[model samples]
Target: MNNDKKIRRSRNRLIAGVCAGIAEYFKINPWVIRGLFIILLLIPHIQFVTICIYVVLLAILPAPKGSFFENFRAHFGEQGRAASAEHKQRSTSTSNRRIIKDVREHDIH
Candidate 1:
């Protein structure tokens, strides 16, 4: 396993991406890490320590570039772009039709 890869915070984060980053680094499921964290918090007198560690991780780990949703959209490649373009075209066409209708109604008055 390569240890040199910098552990950056994940964009797909509910809280701070600490668990996600650790899961990604270790090739494990993020839920498992999150569960472990919750379990750790439940231990007697460990809640404070667990919170401190989480905060420390948040402070130390660098955040990954771009947001999770952006990355997810990027993965869809051309299909995502095409959908966005088509939506914009439809919006403009609808607006143009509305404007033309309003003008025709005004001219009849």
Candidate 2:
């Protein structure tokens, strides 16, 4: 719930959440992000470079509270505020929290 660091989306991850996280940051679809990444890779040896960049970004980026893309949607003024607030709530909630959902489900068995 820290306003300073943007959390990446853990629920969405095709490739380390790099494309999905960036898409969420920019309020775009993860598919679009993945497409752009693929296009970027098509250019000569950029694939390796892009992979490296993705890896580095993934390691450096923080996971978003719920849907990683929600944070970026906050830039749109009113909607952004609402989305940010919703994300904060989902992130900070005592129950059904994203990170804990896994643990809770595990305990259910």
Query: Could you say which candidate leads in TM-score?
Result: 1
Candidate 2: list runs displaced more than 4 Å.
1-7, 64-109
Pairs that collide, model 1: none
TM-score for all models, in order of appearance:
0.57, 0.49
lDDT of 1 at 1: 40
Best by lDDT: 1
Per-residue alpha-carbon lDDT of model 1 for 59-90, expressed as tens digits?
Answer: 88777868664466467867888989998998
Note the clash tally of each candidate.
0, 7
Q: Predict model 2's lDDT versus the native.
A: 0.72
Predicted candidate 2 versus true structure: per-residue lDDT over 1-109, tens digit per residue: 3456465655678656778877776776789979988899899878899888887887677656645344554445578788899999998887884443445335554
| C-alpha lDDT of residue 70 in model 1 | 45
User: Residue 9 deviation, candidate 2, in Å?
Assistant: 3.7
Checking candidate 2 for backbone clashes, the offending pairs are: 7-63, 7-64, 8-62, 8-63, 8-64, 24-69, 74-80
